[model samples]
Target chain A: MSLDQSFVGRTYPPTAPYQVGREKIREFASAIGATDPAHHDPEAARALGHPDVVAPPTFPVVLTMAASRQLIEDPALGIDYSRVVHGDQRFAYTRPVVAGDELICVNTVEDITSRGGHEFLTTRTDVTTTAGEPVVAVWSKLVVRGEA
Target chain B: MELPTQTFQVTRADLVRYAGASGDFNPIHYSDRFATKVGLPGVIAHGMFTMALVGRAVTTWAGAPDAVVDYGVRFTRPVVVPDDDTGTEIVVSAVVREVTETGLTRLDITATCQGDKVLSQARATVRTAG
Candidate 1:
């Protein structure tokens, strides 16, 4: 089934503010096997000029991916969550994320295409502070595998 | 004070184990033929798996298990894992970029395979205990 092309440019409402926390950063880092002091130690991070412990680059996945539910669950979009497989991901950042930041995500469906009996969905999520400061933009590609 | 970097060889066993743990079963990551057919030089590791290694490097330094709050990366290139004698070696590195008032720290990160930067412009945010 083809996706609703009309949704390609639709922008969803801003998500509830997500407070970035320190321990959560540590957990994400540990889960991915990151062993960098800057991810947890204030002194070490301070040495590098950061205001607080920094998160691993992949940390946005924890929230943006979760926010994807808004689009995936939308019946009008016709996305089949069960058939979906992550195809690729990319991030563009104006600055690194830090704890104490109040973030809200705005999701947009960038494109929809079909090839080889498979559907491809591309979504972009923008993370920003409540004051409208842009932090990062994440683009994700999902492929819905065909049933043979 | 100093950037953290580590290099280690990845084995087929490591890839298989990560696949099981992460629940990602892309044939190109495990099947040589599938990988070759898909135009990869050989089976390649999952980008997230490599990213996971970067996270591990950070957590090891943080000394805590659950401190990461924000993380993001751009996949500049794919890590092509060849079916050869030497396997693959991945190097992970990070630098402290900034500190925040609420005890949050930010880092610049990178993931390289051999000499190529498979992932670039990576950054993360972690919080400290109050």
Candidate 2:
């Protein structure tokens, strides 16, 4: 079944605040083999003017992915998780993500299109600190393949 | 001018670690059975994993971990990782597209696995720190 085009431009409610942990940033950096000192050592990050360990550019995917569940699991949207493949991803930052910052995300359906028998759903997630400081805007396009 | 190339090795173990860290436990990334059932060649690295590697390369080139202000990529192909000791490799190369008066350096990046492009339209903007 094709996705409802009406979902486009729909913005979901803001997610609960998620505390960005220093160790989680370290773990994420280590997993990707990003050995930058600013990613793991608070002192190094401080040396560079960040308050604490700074997350790498793609780190917000951790939060936004969890936040996006609101759209993927929306019974009305009817996204077939098993048939979905990531099509595109992008992030534009207002500032680098740092540890100890409590973050929240609001996901919005940006676009929906069908091509070659597949539905492409583009979602944009606006990430901000609990205090309403904008952190980054993340966009992800997922392709829901049509059953053969 | 072209920037120095960065290389990263991807293994099944790396995928497992990434899945745990990113909270994206999609079976297609770690389970060969589920991957094949889903019509994939075999267990594949998460697209975000590859994107993170490319982000590392970008940050390395920028000389600061927090330099990146904007980054984007299209997943053009799967980076298949067979169960092995010496897994696959992703080679990242980039060119400086522009440097603005405000100290932002824009880059056009390319990421390849086994000489095949895995990401397309990859680009990043970094704050040029003194």
Candidate 3:
């Protein structure tokens, strides 16, 4: 089934504030097998001029991916999750994530296109601090395989 | 304006292990025949896996094992991994580019496979102690 074209350009509400914690960052790093000190030790981060532990550059994926659920689960969108495969992802950052930041993400369905038995959905997630500081914007594309 | 980088190869086994660990069992990453059938030159690494590696390079360089405040990436190109004894090598790198008055540090980052930019125009930020 094709995605609802009307949903294109629709923006969802900002997510609840997510506190960037030292432990969460550490867990994500460990989950990804990242063995970086800056992602685990505050002292090590501070020594490198950080106020506390810093998250890896891709940390915003957690926030954005969560925010994007609004689109995937939108009843009006008519997306078939079972047929979807991640086509691509990219992040444009204004800054690196750090512990002690309260961040929020706003999700938008940027575009939806269909071609040759495939549906392409593009979503964008904007990450910001509670104070409205821009952190990064994540754009992801998902391709839905043809119905067998 | 930035610290030196730590470079290393990310092998095919590493990609396979990452796929198992991440629960992203996409055949294009493991099955070479499936990968070739899909028109990719050969088996390719997951873009997220490479993105995770870039995150590793930045956090490790900052000296904090956990200090990432914000990070994002775009998959401009795919990393093709040919079945060979040495496998494909992905080199992740980053350098401090700017410092803001709010004590935020921005780093320009990249993840390359065989010198071709797989992830491009990447950036990340961290807060510094005043």
Candidate 4:
């Protein structure tokens, strides 16, 4: 089934503030084997001008994925979680996220289209500081595969 | 010019670690049964995991942890990670696409697993360390 076309361009309310933690950044960096000192050593990050430990480029997904649950589990939108596969991901950064940042996500449904019995839904997440500093914009494409 | 290639190994263990760290508890990354039930060949690595590996390569090339200003990728294929020790390998290769007057460097990236390109349209813009 195709996604609700009316949902396109619908923007959701901002999420609660998510505190970016030092330990969490370390864990994320280690999980991917990113051994750059700036990801773990606050002093190293400070030398680079970041306020605290710097997160990897894809780290925002950690929070944005959780924030996007608002749409995926929307009873009205009715997305099948089991049949979903990721299609594309993009991140444009105004600045790299650091450990001390308090981030919030605003999710918007950018587009929805169906082709070849598959439905594609693109969601753009605008991540910012609680103080409204734009951090980065993340875009994700989820494909819902049709049963044969 | 092509940057030096980097190779990273992905195992079910790495996926589990990533899942816990990223809060993505998708069964497809850990349970082969659920993966095949959903018509997948086997437990697959998370798309984000693969992207993170590529990000590591980008930063390594730029010599800075916070170098990436922009990054993007299209998941064209799954990296089936086995439960064994040497599960799978992702090879990342990139070429310098352009250097802007503003000092930003753009790279066209490629990630392959088992000889199949797993990510397409992969690219990154990084502020290289002077």
Candidate 2, CAPRI quality class derived from DockQ: high
TM-score, ranked from best to worst: 2, 4, 3, 1
Relative to the true structure, how large is the alpha-carbon lDDT of every model? 0.75, 0.95, 0.76, 0.94
Model 1 stretches astray by more than 4 angstroms: B1-47, B54-130
Off by over 4 Å in 2: none
Clashing residue pairs, backbone N/CA/C < 3 A, model 4: none
lDDT by residue for model 4 over A1-148, one digit each (tens)? 5578899999999999999999999999999998889999999999999889999999999999999999998977768877889999999999999998999999999999988999999999999999999999999999999877
Report the Cα RMSD per candidate: 8.2, 0.7, 5.5, 0.8
- The model with the greater DockQ, 1 or 4, is 4
In candidate 4, what are the lDDT values of residues B1-42, reduced to their tens digit? 999999998888999999999999989999999899888899
TM-score of chain A of each: 0.96, 0.98, 0.94, 0.98
- The TM-scores of all predictions, comma-separated, are 0.62, 0.99, 0.64, 0.98
Candidate 1: CAPRI quality band: incorrect
lDDT: worst 10-residue window of model 4 chain A: A75-84
Off by over 4 Å in 3: A1-3, A9-31, A36-108, A112-120, A124-139, A143-148
- Quote model 2's iRMS: 0.5
lDDT head-to-head 1 vs 3, winner:
3
Candidates' interface RMSDs, in order? Answer: 6.0, 0.5, 4.3, 0.5
Model 2 clashing residue pairs (backbone): none
Put down candidate 2 lDDT per residue, A1-148, tens digits, no spaces: 6798899899999999999999999999999998989999999999999999999899999999999999988989989988899999999999999999999999999999999899999999999999999999999999999998
Local error of candidate 2 at B5, Å?
0.9
